[model samples]
Target: MPAAALKPKPLPTQSTAKRPVQLDLPYAPVAKRPLPAGRPREWYVTHNRRLKAMRLAIALLDSGVYVPNQARNETIRSTARRIGVHPPSDTTCHMVRALMRYTR
Candidate 1:
């Protein structure tokens, strides 16, 4: 039994592998929760800013804006407008870019 004679034939590759079907499911409606009580004012502000930044980052990603440099302040503000969110302040825009950068 020579080692070279024991080589196995290569397996065939599928052009399209099986993928899970995408379902167009609707989400159940849920009430928005109020912020917890007793938090400092600055804490609330920072929390809200972070939430806005996350939302902006998600919108940017869905619109094919992957790079931080591609998501300039104007672009972010424009996206905010499209998404019905108020135009983000310069600081919020910077935070959005930072989120995209670190997530990458």
Candidate 2:
């Protein structure tokens, strides 16, 4: 066979189908409680404390003031004490470990 005859024919191009149009709906007011009122005062206090501990841990890690190691529990507890967060929770300690890992 001739070289030209050996060439394969190209496949036909696919036609695109029209997509359905989406309609925008007007915003509706949701029956939700106000932010502060939604949560108890103690809840907010605990959340703030956790946030403070996490921020302090990250700052200490960045400043080379606290080094996170395999003994993370001790590191977290000591860091919390140094930063004046007494009796850091397990959640706060875990957050410290996460932050340390993230920075690395």
Per-residue lDDT of 15 in model 1: 40
Position 33, candidate 1: lDDT: 98
Residue range with the least summed lDDT across 10 consecutive positions in model 1: 11-20
Model 1 off-target regions past 4 Å?
Answer: 1-30
Relative to the true structure, how large is the alpha-carbon lDDT of every model?
A: 0.93, 0.66
Quantify how close model 2 is to the true structure by its C-alpha RMSD in Å.
15.0
> In model 2, what are the clashing residue pairs, if there are any?
none
Cα distance off (Å), candidate 1, residue 24: 6.1
Candidate 1 to truth, TM? 0.74
* lDDT score, candidate 2, position 83: 64
Candidate 1 clash figure, as a count: 0
Which lDDT tens digits does candidate 2 get at residues 1-104? 79989999664433432554454686796796644767888898777776776776765665575445652676667766776777667777777766666766
TM-scores for the candidates: 0.74, 0.45
State residue 100's C-alpha deviation in candidate 1, in Å: 0.3
Please tell me which predicted candidate would have the highest TM-score against the true structure: 1
